[model samples]
Target: MELKNRHKKCINFDLDTKELLKYFPKGTRKPYALIKEFFEKQGFDHRQYSGYISKEPISDYKLTKIIHQLSIQYIWLKNCIKEFDVSNAPQTLSLKNQIYNSIEKEENKIYNQFIQKLRYYQSKKKILNSSTKIKYEKELLNLYQKLEKNHINLDEKSLKSMREIAKTKSLKR
Candidate 1:
């Protein structure tokens, strides 16, 4: 394994549909079918990848951008899934509304807590040091994560996505 045996070669690689799902959840929550639906909804001809995409030689930089975009799309799709899904399901909208209300309530509750704590400190004339501020920001993020797990608007799709994003558990459990 000396420098005399150095190798500097890049072989051709073919991308597949699996590449599109590369950023998606890895386990049962991968939501392959749902992601496929999202691809179709976005008018991405993934099937054509086999015919044209694989045949073409993409630059390393371009391929990196493509994969990065796929990851972002996974995030965008999950966040917006409930909005579109809720619109599609009109029959039991009341239940959906309840979920939405609960989500809103949860958000407000957290916001109120933050404000109250801030005011309490202000009333005491206590200075919020840098470390405390950073800790507070992390705490806020944690609370928001918890609320969103019930999912934004408290809908099922968002909940599923949240579960996928969560490192601690999966929806399967």
Candidate 2:
């Protein structure tokens, strides 16, 4: 499938750094530059990439890279929010809330894409011949293991179901 169609199927998050900056504490120096630098450090150049990494295709290797980058950004953003003394400034508190929301949204998008891929492979297994079934099963298992290594959660039931499919296919031959 084309990258555009894959993206259309996944959850979309509006990662507008400019809009995000509007909630930041007033009088902060070089907010735009700071946000730009943050993104760049996250392995994304907003100017060159045209936006965040969330729009990238969810192929196994690319998905791993995207999730890793997002996890790094999530940690950095959380730390930045914590460093702010929001006690005296309502605006700062609001900005923190906005940042938290963005983090959650990004994480959700990652998980949604992961689940979608698992489902895609699971559905494909049904139509594939026994010979090809093992190949698809291996791919699915590898994807699951990679996600687990990165600390991304998989639905236990879904994992079990995939395993059973693979087991049954193997037993057939």
Candidate 3:
């Protein structure tokens, strides 16, 4: 500590740092390789990893509380994933199918409009002019924004997220 503080410019910690940080890993450079090494150490194929970790309840309450509170914008996607897990009823299936169709149609319409614009540009033998390029980028951004809006709907998702956060706060008290 004194050497590091005194010789801050030279920074002569190469020898002492190893002894200090020996408890914690110093190397395993890449994250992916580290993850792979961890799984391999855990014998992931043999399910030995379960023994090292505490058991969690098989309930959506925790997931909902965590994901909804922290990542409000992605509440719909998490809800959709939860819905997919145990969607058995005919009504549920029909509703999911209807939603899928609606989402598909909207996405297709946006894509088709962009395609038409591209075709118009092609038809005119234009070499991607500035205004046309701007329009292209605008269309792409519009499509992305629409999809994000669809996911974070006020009544369906964002409201639910707020309610979930409130529920957790109440529980904590």
Candidate 4:
């Protein structure tokens, strides 16, 4: 299995599949199979992969798609938190926080790459006017700002709250 041989496929099962199956009857065999294929393709241990696909650097297009999907999930989760009863609030919030952490991690990874690219562009002897450079700088700034806006910050306080909620939920169970 080589890195070049790995192809993107729809995954059906994830870490939460078992929990989700309690609510929905259909299992995600297709997606899970796809993930298994990816693991095999990469010569990784499928049992340990945990379905986190972006451990290696991904293409910009794939990154964009992931960010978009995460953003949509973030919005939906926020709405769910707002609308759900207090009894279920902790679980929803914990899930939301987890998603937020993922988004932030991805953004930070991309941001470092973005800066490296910009630095490389500067080091190269390319034809550029001051106006063009300014335009490029503004565009980069805008991209950073856009990513920042999409990121959800889960502070220490929130983590404490989530932990408390988890404990309470476990006690109830």
Per-residue lDDT tens digits for candidate 4, residues 1-173, read: 44453343322223455543443357745444554664455433343334323334334455446546544633423322212110111111127788879977888776665465455445541576756755655554555455447663334553353345346446656
Candidate 4's C-alpha lDDT?
Answer: 0.46
- Choose the strongest candidate by lDDT: 2
| Candidate 2 TM-score, true structure as reference | 0.30
Of candidate 3, the 10-residue stretch with the lowest lDDT total is 6-15
Worst 10 residues of 4 by lDDT: 84-93
Off by over 4 Å in 2: 1-113, 165-173
Misplaced by over 4 Å in model 1 are: 1-94, 125-173
lDDT of each: 0.43, 0.52, 0.38, 0.46
Report the number of backbone clashes for model 3: 0
RMSD to the hidden true structure, all candidates: 22.7, 21.0, 26.5, 23.8
Cα-based RMSD of candidate 1: 22.7
Question: Sorted on lDDT, highest at the top, how do the candidates line up?
Answer: 2, 4, 1, 3
Query: Which scores higher on lDDT, 2 or 4?
Result: 2
Which residue pairs in candidate 3 collide? none
Q: On residues 46-102, what C-alpha lDDT tens digit does candidate 2 reach at each position?
A: 533223332233444454564466557555344333222101111211277888799
